[model samples]
Target: MRALLLTAVAVAVALPVIPAQTWSTTACGPAAVSVGDYRQYEGTGSGTTPFSFTVTVTTAPGCTATGSVAYATEHISTGPADITATSGTLTWTDSTDAKLVVVGVVRDGTPEPEEAFSLRLHTPQNLVITRDRGRGQIIDDDLPPVETGLDGGKICWRYESSAVEVGVHTNTPARAPITVHYRTVHTGSNPPGYYPVKDGIITIPTGSTRGTATIRLKTEPNLPDEQFYVEIFSPSAGTLGLSRVPITVKSKR
Candidate 1:
């Protein structure tokens, strides 16, 4: 997630009458030396490596002087390693820059009014959604009923709603909400167990996969399918369209 704004403002001279040149450098937060593990400036302004700065200059009708200002860069790791059994992935990052300005009135007389602005940058977002490919078939389409289930590794859905890390002009899209639906099919009398009825998959085609309604349900044989129509809608776009999966059953007696 990234955002940028070029704010144009009238340079206030701090109500002080100046005719020539003026220069001042105000430092901020020691100006972060590095980002997570990546250095920014390589110690260009700060003492440590990767140090960077934001320079601002204000000149009247005629002024000659250099401006020196400092800013900080902080990172809030995305897709942290602590989130437990979360439905989807979440990310956090601090990408805001500090705005420091040095003005020379560039006019008759007006107070600089302790001008201060905030500059923030965004870090890259990391979201992951996963689902297994259709391995063969659950029913097998054979006789004797399979009565078995397949494993669909970690199914996930990920998205971001904010863009503070990706920086400006970044195609890195934020995560979005996702929902799932499923169709269940079971034969024979029945059995008891935590069957692989409904689950979510993270990996998908593209776009935010959110649940708009319920998952669509249908039976192979319409007659016995019974209420065979369940509606499922995803608010966001994703790879998986169904959520619940049912295995077929067979009885000899």
Candidate 2:
């Protein structure tokens, strides 16, 4: 009887010390939609509290349905809690080239699942990019500047109003992803040699008409100077495209 009494007292003492548990669903996890596409999503909530969610695609130039997000709220005042609840599936297509998706989730007045999902696609990475020089294919093989002296190369980038809009790529996390830029030596094997730079990403000013610039890649004498990889990112113009160039660096001396 004494043992039973001790057990009952312990249960009573511990009841008040428990904390509320948080819950979430994978509705916003890396959502993928083609350019001009849309997605419809839904999920069940817990207890009497209302459930809600918000969407963000760090790789923007993307939008919700109706130039905004479409949503409907449902209330479950009395139902057995079921883990079988499913979040909505978004419906989307290629628009403004391509887009990346990131989503957040909340439940029962608590924002538990933050940054719980992400999605990647093969749509417009850049608006306008070069496929090859007049008579030569673009190329670059060196590598990032971490080991090499250079980052990228003196390859040129081109874009037009039709190719890209001022705010088209504002949502992309990095200045430009791999697909938006292409890497080709200023002049292919035109007397190849050791070329080096500080980093891989190159900077060019946006021109009202068109623009050209030189980008360098990191290099090291100990590394092979004969061939290197040039990163290429093509504009979505209508969809995202990423590519790479190969350069056969000839010895300068």
Candidate 3:
């Protein structure tokens, strides 16, 4: 009988072939659904430094997306809210793959100017947020770099003087407008008309931290006991402290 029909077709090909039962959906049409968009984090002032934002979620293949994603902070007073977010609630099982939601920003070293905030995405059940909202920027880095000094070291001229007032101090407060440069040093008795001796420019005005450089001495009339020096060179924004300032000319009484 043809060997009993070839042993019954090899026992029906060794039987056993079953795999079709992966039903567990929460229903999410439109090719499964997706949500991703959060790119804007520029903060490193080191007040605790930490500015990160990445929110992404895409599910479909057997779906199991549970939700509760809510983030807040929009147009805050340009500062204060610190920032923090690692999970606002978003669980997924049998996921289609692609899930990451992290947002953290908390660096308050104090010193602001460029600031903006916005990252919103709320209440999503079966999952569907093709790009909620994202826009964050905190670039102020705590503006600290503006130091110049010479409030008083010495200044006494009265031998044909016309002006004398040297006081330039700035540690912070001049967001704009600055200029500093002065020269004149005869050491001691170089009498021939000394005062301002050429080279000057001290104009710091924007919020004013103090700036005054008015020197002009040359009375011409047998001068002695002279001692000159008013130095503070090249400074358009800071760093020049104690810049040498001493002027005493009293010999014409």
Candidate 4:
């Protein structure tokens, strides 16, 4: 007889969260069946790791019972029909015994909110099922979609300063390393004296939300204020939210 032994990490051994749903009971022929408390796990996009559920049968004196239970996904995907098990066996000896059902949570690239599934007991042989349903919750670990753009629509540059710092920001933290490409385009005539067209890259490291790009400027005295456009484009990771920003370079007095 292959008996299932409770492991140190078994959900039955650990204190479990009480399920919010109410349970119904039926008279056992001699023993009663019940599922352990609810279980939860993070939803990683892997098939190897699975969620474990414990189904238990409490036996009365000299009461040996047999039964079957089924697993169904209420808001999760487990298989073709979203069903994990159609007829899983549950057996009870004179003492209490438990069976564990391991089921996988399907993965997807699309980010989703927390979801759940359920297991129910049925078709018992010489036993009653009291607390039939067990629930499993999946905490979503997928990163949400993010957008990146310039932190400000306009920046002011003093004629005497050699460089101006521009901020690049994302709506949310980067899931991976992100590179934002920006360049200064001539909106009007370039400022007098060795004005170099600025092409810069701002790198936002993984888990960071912001980066800075430096735009070097060269200005001469007694010249009209000039304007230029900073074009935000070609982000390596996320969609571009704001594309164009204006910068004003004031000539020295």
- What lDDT does each candidate get? 0.22, 0.26, 0.60, 0.62
Please estimate how well model 2 matches the true structure, expressed as its whole-model Cα lDDT.
0.26
Query: Best TM-score goes to which candidate?
Result: 4
lDDT (10s digit) by residue, model 1, range 130-209: 21111110111112111111222121111111111100110212132222333334343423211333433222122322
Model 3 CA deviation exceeding 4 Å by range = 1-77, 80-142, 151-156, 167-174, 177-203, 206-210, 213-249
Best by lDDT: 4
lDDT of 2 by residue, 151-224 (tens): 32322122111111111121222211111233443443533333432233422222211222233433434332
Model 1, which residues run further than 4 Å from truth?
1-189, 206-235, 238-247, 250-253
lDDT of 3 by residue, 1-253 (tens): 3554434344445768889989776666532334434432233334333334456665555544455455554554344556653336555554454555455666544565666566666666656777766666554434664667778755465664566777888887665556677877776445445544568888778677888877776675566656677888766543566888777767575
Q: Cα deviation in Å at residue 51, candidate 2?
A: 28
The residue pairs that clash in candidate 4, if any, are 28-128
Measured over all alpha carbons after superposition, the RMSD of each candidate to the real structure, in angstroms, is: 28.5, 23.8, 20.3, 22.7
Q: Which whole-number lDDT from 0 to 100 does residue 123 have in model 3?
A: 67
True lDDT of residue 171, candidate 1: 21
lDDT of 4: 0.62
